[model samples]
Target: MNIELVPERQYQVFNSVAGRHHHHQPIWQNIKNLLKSCFGTQSDSRLLNRDGSLIDINRLRQNINDKQQSYKKRHITWPYLLNIYSPSMTNSDKKIYQNRARIRYNRLKRTWQERVSQGDSFYVTLADTILKDVRRTDRHIKFFKKKKQILFNIMMTYSVYHPNPGYSQGMTDMLTPIVYVFIDESMSYFAFCSLMNRYMSSLFDQDQIEINRRIRLFNLILHSIDNELWNKINVNEENYLYVYRWLLLDCKREFYRFNHVLRVLELVWINSISPFVISQSITNYRSLFTIFICISILQEDRQIIFSYSNDEDLHKYFFSSSSSSRSHRSTKRILQQAQINYSNYILSQK
Candidate 1:
């Protein structure tokens, strides 16, 4: 069977099973209600405000307090910093407790060291690279150092937890935005893992099967959309390596703001719309939507790309273009163009 058919088959099986399990409706409905309540029915205008000014600290604090109260009332197990910081040891018992804790910490440290030694060298190199680029001069030096440490810890913990795909070069880039948003290392780690498993698991596959599959799918889509441009590039699947980082990191490095990346990711996560409308009924094509997004991005640069006469020029263009942050489009525009292109492509197929 074609590898591409697997996702479609899985979707079909899932839908069939879901149809039979009508009893699950209430559970799903409850989950939807919970999410709506947690996130609110309408988007918060304060967060969405694009004005170039400092955030209203008082409003932010109140929003956080409201969320905490809601979570507490609903008995949601939110991790509190106090739980990690507060010690139960009394003045008299402090010595004994300290000794026990030191012993436990030593054992864990030794185990962690052993695991780190056994981890992939490539991941270690990537982790080190991530740490080097983790901070910016705009932030306080000490605060930036602390954030780098938190990021390092999160990457190490995730690598240990997922030993098979231990770590990949782009994994750190993927986690950076998540860690920045969550702030708390533990929460960020959990969110990173969830995202990896849900949307980015393939990118880390040892066999490179999933990444290659997506690349091929992307090539086909590009060809279908504009064979002239596709042929002009004069590259095969291997030459399309330029797109690997984009897909793997989900354009995290491309976008200027982390919030913009988050917005794009949220839409990608939804995966309700299909790139090819003709094939929409056959499969949701959820996994291929990112490729469609890439196509949309490429569309923005099509004219510039067409100007290149040779592969070297094109390769250089791609390499130098990373810092061309001005070219990055708004999340809304990217999403709209992607949808429009996908719909047109689907119609063309018909």
Candidate 2:
């Protein structure tokens, strides 16, 4: 029983069972945060255990149900939960994952360092846009203020890889909380890639249809979760601008402290298991859950949203510099409401 092992079998078993039971969610979430500290939201692909057994991709597919259904029904005091042979591992395992993550991080940095030493950004065309966003993104945060160039380069690198739309305005807003969380540029970039490629690609899509598609979906989400607000508001192009801003910035402006923003961002990133692997078969978890998050913000500020006559006024209502307005809104309330909204939408779909 070497505790320092990254057993693929145990990880698979943990994946199959971890968050299924509601009672386990509190501890499970803590474990997940600890893992994120080591892995930076990137799924560790070293899927071999002490016995040299390989990972089974088929078993991983059972997760959508495990995530949705397990919380619906709680099974307490099972042998699986109590057995010493369960999926739980040790701090040494954390050290192993952390070490590998550093290796990956350093390797990526070396490659970038070589290119940087040669004065090659490879994002020459897109640098201007990325730079402008980086300059003004988060000046209040000391790290963001100091590492402006690094943030600029990360977005530039992303542009070089994903040249479709190159770069957009609010993309930096999406990157801010991620960089803050990972606190390492290389891991942050990879984590950012996982997040964007997951369900957020649409918001940056060129045809502009996908962005609109998300707006339409938002209306459906709003209708489902808060019909009162939905009925009160007119669903038109004018209001779509509001939703567009929300999608682009990922509701970062909704919260006062950046920690609250990190919580929501991690909420979207945590449910995602295969961070590096993009699969069409897996349901779009980020897409659906993100909508619920937006709705939660809107629901929290329902009175403010309705009290204002125009979008301009409502925009100022939430985004105003007065931190008090945003501070009162609880992160727990936002998350709990989001889950409730998601559950309602899921039940309605069935």
Candidate 3:
């Protein structure tokens, strides 16, 4: 169970059971596939057969055309503005729609640029982290680097292995930190793969298993720790959902203290003692403490959170709370309580 120390082959078997078809591949191959998928041609069919033949091209085209017509009628497009200038639509409406489109596209472009830049940073930082850890004198660092390389090769070969779930922005986000910490590309890759295999089913599809798992654990812990607050939150049906941002990024987006985040991760790893801790915590009672910890953090910043009615304020609060000492203390208390409950629960189970 000490995955960090076990032989590579043992975990290789565990990985296979977790549904990975490849544990090794060339770096160039993964990069090639990623490029192809991003820029290559794609199918236009709305539906497809088992073998991938188009099932409804005409209907799909018709649907697209209908939507286009609807946009025209609603004065929501460039053509609609042309009509307005030609006296078909009023000047006021024309200016409004054009401005809206310009504003929307500008915003979209800004977001795209940011994600692209972040993705680039993530890739470089991850690669550097892996290489740096490998060069360190620690013996664990060396072995970990070997394993990480295997995983890296596999990821590079992702297109040939799991074509349907090829590289995603989130994948890079998940991989970067592991590579930095572990230094072995293969080990980091497998660790990340192990994690993704266990939790990412909800990511690419509509299956709510992962989300439900979080909600259930959140409810269980809230019910255990503070029934009064639990009842209040439940009445609003917003316990786990309120904490969605934290879960989505593994608390990277929420916690300001890197050391604190690592401690929480260690607690989670120890509590569930499962590699699939993120998702498993959703169903395990011990995960309740994790949610409680989150609530405690937020409650300490109640004024900051509730004071903000819009995104700008929320963003400001997020940065502000990251460095706040008061909130950090509450987080530590929550973790301590979680440990007490976890110990009590284990004793009772035995």
- Which has the greatest TM-score? 2
- How do these models rank on lDDT, best leading? 2, 1, 3
For candidate 1, report its TM-score: 0.58
lDDT of 1 by residue, 147-182 (tens): 777777667667766877876676766665555555
Off by over 4 Å in 2: 1-125, 235-237, 272-283, 309-312, 315-325
Q: After superposition, how far is residue 343 of candidate 1 from its true place, in Å?
A: 4.0
Off by over 4 Å in 3: 1-160, 163-169, 198-205, 231-240, 274-289, 295-331, 344-350
> Residue 183 of candidate 3: its Cα lDDT?
46
* lDDT, residue 81, model 2: 17
Kindly report which residue pairs in candidate 2 clash with one another.
none
lDDT of 3 by residue, 241-339 (tens): 546545544554354544455445434433332322343332443244455556566555555556555655555544443345343455466566655
Per-residue C-alpha lDDT of model 2 across residues 1-350, encoded as one tens digit per residue: 24585699998887678657567678867978887755543222333233323233233233322232121111111111112112343435534654675676566556645665667656333566677889988887777878887787678777766766667777888887667655666656766676667557667877888777667888876876678888666533465576777766667777887766755655554444432211232345666677778888878878777888776675566456566777878777888888787777667665
Clashes of 2: 0
